[model samples]
Target chain A: MSTGSAPPILETKALTRSFSGFTAVNSVDLTIGEGTVHALVGPNGAGKTTLFNLLTGFLTPSSGTIHFQGRDITGMDPERIVPLGLARSFQITSLFEQMSLLEHLELALASGTGLTRKFWKSVKVLGRFHDRGMQHLEEVGLADRANQAAGSLSYGQKRALELALALALEPKLLLLDEPTAGMGLEDVDRTIELIQRLRHGRTVVFVDHNMHVVGSLADEVTVLQSGQILAQGTYDAVRADERVITAYLGESHA
Target chain B: MSEHLVGTSHLETAATAAPERRERAWARPLYLLLALLLACALPWFIYPPIALDILCWGLFAISVDLLLGYTGLLSFGHAAFWGSSAYITGIVAIETGMPFPVAILLGALAAMVIAVPTGWLAVRSTGIYFAMVTLAFAQMLYFVANRASGLTGGENGLQGIPRPFFGMELIETEAFYFYYAALPLIILGCFIAWRTVHSPFGRVLLAIRDNPARARALGFDVEGYKIVVFVISAGIAGVAGGVFSSGHGFASLNDLMWTTSGKAVLITVLGGIGTLWGAMVGSGILVTLEDYLTTLGFEGIGIVTGTMFIVIVLLFRRGIWGSVQQAWHWALGKARLRWG
Candidate 1:
């Protein structure tokens, strides 16, 4: 993918992170093509989340480089990285529990316009973003709950809201960390459908334990084991690989 | 179509929610007006100096609330701003003979300047560490004030802070007159704070307070918001301090002590940590009680206030104003159920 004529939207070279003596992500070289949904699949301790953290600038890599749209973004702060068209949703849902869903979307919308820093102006000025915020909420099937506090949302709904928030950023490269983790079967289907709709015009990198979600949504799949890439190719190619079956798929499939 | 039915139902729910939201909104301005009237009449009921004390302390508590309640920053060194402003206001008044308002402005600006470095260092830490860092800074300032006896009046305290007239012969700087004179500025400060919390900036602060990591991911400079709020809070506290010192013609070491910071925090918790109006309520109760006890020759006022604090915490976990607001909403819900 990196060797293709069209430049990759996101690329990582020798990406590595360690916590004291324990290395979480070791020498990961990843390349994600534009407008394609990429899945990072691994077992529980396979360093998928740590790799996401490094890519999104949440955690600084011990030794590595991250490039977004050909710009070096290694060890940059999350706040700085986001403005460059990279956004991520956490594995565990994170939100302002007391704020209404619409308010959350409005804040995300206002963030892009540089209006979130205006302490002197009345919040009424954000009324301009109201319709757009509702549109984003509607996209995630959350428009009906727009007025409710985020804390009142169910597990599935909160994950949907998190997706809505990341989408509000209008990021060029969207990262989803275990987007279907802990979701019900019904919710999992809805989320997969939601991601399917969202996959147009942007690059997506997601970590998931659900092979079904991986098969349906992922155009390319990278399987990891013990902080190293075990297989990288199309979903079917990676699924058929012997190392992946023995290291990851064996336990779940068996 | 089914879509039409869903849309109509959504509108129906929205319509039902609107009136309750409006009713709650309308209650705020009305309560504010009533409070204003009560504040205007307070001097007539009690000693004017004590009334003035209530106003200053009320503003102080509100400043603390801006950090503790809104930004989720617990500052234990707010006395640095309050005391520094008091000392600066006194010094400016005595040396430059500037109008008290100008002096107060400079004092507030000084507080903001101090906050830049203090907040920059302190905001990098969270929770108890943030509080400890702030307390350490305040203690440093306190010792500096003590050691620099030549400027800060050392242990003697800065005295004879004049309440300069506002370019009119009829205006007086007496406690009663000054209370009315200062009330407008205090109201303006309160208005600034109110506008701040309701502004986009305030929403970001709330977002940061709720989940800093998520906020950062959303492209918000969470540390920047914290520092900005910290400085703003200090400036407001500075205004209160300047007014307090000028009102009494005294800027004492007590104003800068860690105890003073504790007192402001205690009052905020008493009133309701997050409610702006609660600061005033807490201040009124605390200042009035202190005055009443002093008049009765009671030396151990802390004992009574501490016990009250414990009881309030146990019974009203959200504080007095918070509990009252909650009950009001609960009653409103019940009334709606019955009437509608």
Candidate 2:
């Protein structure tokens, strides 16, 4: 529950990534301040997802470093980074199709506590898990659908459950990859309310193509294009800039 | 009944329940007593040698099933370890005269030693590649066993392997003593396997089988876990093979052959892939059927067993035990829907 004008919780120093002789991301330096809602907005294929991947250990950077709380964490695997209080919900809904939504989060929450698969003997003592898990489901307004198959949930409810599982981690830094990616207007409004509630005491870095969400919730905005930082400022400043308009809008904004 | 009310969603709820963990606590020892009674009767009704042979083979299948059903890694070359241990156990028992159990320990050590190197490679891959790598390596072990005449039996195999059970010079009149002697080893082996499967470590293995990448993301040492289980599985197979050598009083290159591995695979498939006891049931049905068919002057149990494999594959993805589980669920589900 860190707060205030403290140092950036996550920062990339000249981070670069190349794949199969193609430069997917190049020298994209970004900073996400502690307990702030940082939005990364870009067109499709603008390497926002690639930057998210690098930050979250889904992809290794070709060069440069990532620092969390001023410690160089470059090239660390996702498993190791998790114990350091960084957790991420997936871009694609990667819920176990066969598992119930409650089961999915219970297992996630259990593992997030650094519990390994063996020692199933402690399964009898899972009362704390249920209590905390139900609280998380309540947070994202998914308490009613707690027992549903995650895959069977409507597109928006699935996203909400995914958010609830991320909340279960109680992470210092949360990476939400398009948390409201495919939702109805009502679902999107609920997601915004949920996001607002989550922005205190924990840092949130999210990527979305939706300008409206970004404009409303972002404390600061970083715009990416082809893996490089195209612009960085407050939402109004970046949205009003002619460069952002010309670079991102193409013929549509004109 | 309340469990069924949640419907398919309850499958996870039931699986995740705190109270259901106690179900298997008592069931295991009950099975052990039943195994003891069966072992006692093996020598009573059948020739001691044949019954002893079945026990050894059955234990071998059980070991393979641990890897297949519980761990979800289908190994086609378990014979490499099982066969090699038979030779080692056969050689050591004759050379050392160091009691039966001690010799079996040495044999298990040998198989475990081999598994470290081979399993390191096998666990690096998954699915069809895992099976292929294991099968290829086993064939490699077979060739080495065949050519190494100085240490191994070269084709003839080590002979006159002996076991002193109950402080008596084992006599032909008491060939059934082989069954009696191998009983404790089989029981110990099965008990450990069952215990390990029921443990948290086994659940992790199931998690790995269902979704390995997720397990990795959750901070599991996925490959390391696989290699450890591989070695343990090999050790169990080794002990089973060790018992086989003593029962037959011989161990040969035939033990190391690919067909030796295939036999275990055949039993696993016929019994059901992921059902551990189903493998045991498979061994019982297959071995007994072969014995019955041979008496009827029908030498080709292959054609019949082969057809059974196809039918089982097509008819039930859950295999024998799994299908029974699925049907029980479907019935319970229907009953609940009606009542509710």
Candidate 3:
């Protein structure tokens, strides 16, 4: 998808974050090209999620510069970053449990349309966006359950709904953290398909432990171990890297 | 095949979906009209002064509901708005000789001014902490009102606050139709409160209440929204306070008492939190009970009221009016599932 001459759309320069004296994310420079899906892979506690949080502005970096399309966005609030064409789905499902699936979609649609502050207007008047919300739900195959409570959805359905929410923003860059966690084989396949279909013309950075998913879907892969990048290349290249084999796969095996 | 967008709107389809649903919609407005009619007739049935007191308390309870029922913030300092406005309105009316509406506006404005900073600081902590913070602020106001004898008339309070008659000091004549005079303002305040709860802003407040972190993640300025709603709620309380001071002919230290805030909370909870009209119902019941009990020389009436509140809360989780609506929906849904 990249012409190879253009600069990376998102870049982190020696980003580091520490909590109380424990460095969750150490100095790591990551780059993601335009219109490509990049996978962040590591064993547990490798700081993949912390890296995602830093990029998404959920957590401020202890020290580092994060740039999106070459503009600095190191400490921007998640709300501010979202409108800048960057959206994210959480590692754990972040949802309004009491709200219906349609209501969830409506809120995302409302946020995208900048209608959240419209206090005088009834949300029923937002009927114009109802079809659009349904369409997004359809994308995730949750259309039939639109009226069902979000909390009532099965674990896999919740994950699908979470993706649908991020997609509702129609963002240029989507950061997905463990998008397939807790999903069954069929649900994971559907989720992967949905992500694949939606990845066109968008820059995606995702973290997953599933090597098969990373191997098949990622245009590039960055492997991390102990809060540092162990390898970065095409999936096959990174998978074949000797240090990766020793530090990551070898460790997992042992 | 392309998905059909369900061409008709939700309300448009309601007629075909269920006759009961259609009737229920119509019944809501009809019920409201009847309630309004009853409210209009209340002065004839009860002493006008007691009815007027109920209307004032209704407004105050609605203000509390705007935060507690809708936004999910339990404020223990609501009297800070109510009492501050009572004092300000009385003082302004007595000293400045301002028109009734002007005095009310000034009082409401003063409430908004206090709400902004206190709401700003209080919204930082939620639940019990928020309640404590608001209570602390209200206590501060009470102390100030107690000490400021020159301005607030201290323990004696601002007594004999003369109600204006078209900018004329005809306190004697003006007292005759005080309920009728205050009715329009109360109606206007209720209408505005009703409009606000049904507004898009109100929906966000509900979402924030349900899940603040999720609301924040969805790009809502939760703290900022809280402050705005707090100020609005305070302004509404101020309106109630203004009416009370003018109607009762005094602004006393009792207005600033923490128990006043507790009463507003109790009234709201009793009617049904989040039900805008329920506040009025709660206030009406509470005020009427107080009036009847006091007239019969019933002492320690708080015990009776407290026991009733516990029974109501335990039996009807949604409060009186809300429980009725919930039960109706449950029955309707059950019937539809079984027979329809």
| Best DockQ among the predictions, by candidate number | 1
- Two-way DockQ contest, 1 vs 2, winner: 1
What's each prediction's TM-score? 0.94, 0.84, 0.89
Residue-wise C-alpha lDDT for candidate 1, range A1-254, written one tens digit per residue: 32245469998999999999998899999999888889999988899999998988889999989999989999999999998999999999999988888899999988857787888999888888899999998888878878877776667778888999999999999999999888777778778888888888888999999999999999899989999988898888887888888896466664
- Give residue B308's lDDT in candidate 3 (0 to 100): 78
Share of native interface contacts present in candidate 1: 0.56
lDDT of each: 0.88, 0.76, 0.84
The per-residue C-alpha lDDT of model 2 at residue B22 equals 29
TM-score (chain B) of candidate 2: 0.86
Output the lDDT of residue A194, model 1: 83
Output the lDDT of residue B141, model 1: 94
In CAPRI terms, model 3 is classed as acceptable
Error of 3 at A248 (Å): 5.2
Every candidate's chain B TM-score: 0.92, 0.86, 0.89
Taking the tens digit of each residue's C-alpha lDDT, what string does model 3 give over A84-104?
Answer: 888888888878776788888
* lDDT digits (tens) for residues B37-132 of candidate 3: 988899888787888888999999999999998899999999999999999998888988777767987998999999999999999999999999
| Each candidate's DockQ | 0.51, 0.29, 0.36
Give the candidates in order of DockQ, highest first: 1, 3, 2
Which pairs of residues collide in candidate 2? A118-B200, A118-B201, A119-B200, A120-B200, B69-B274
Residue B113 in model 1: lDDT: 97
Question: First chain of model 3: TM-score?
Answer: 0.94
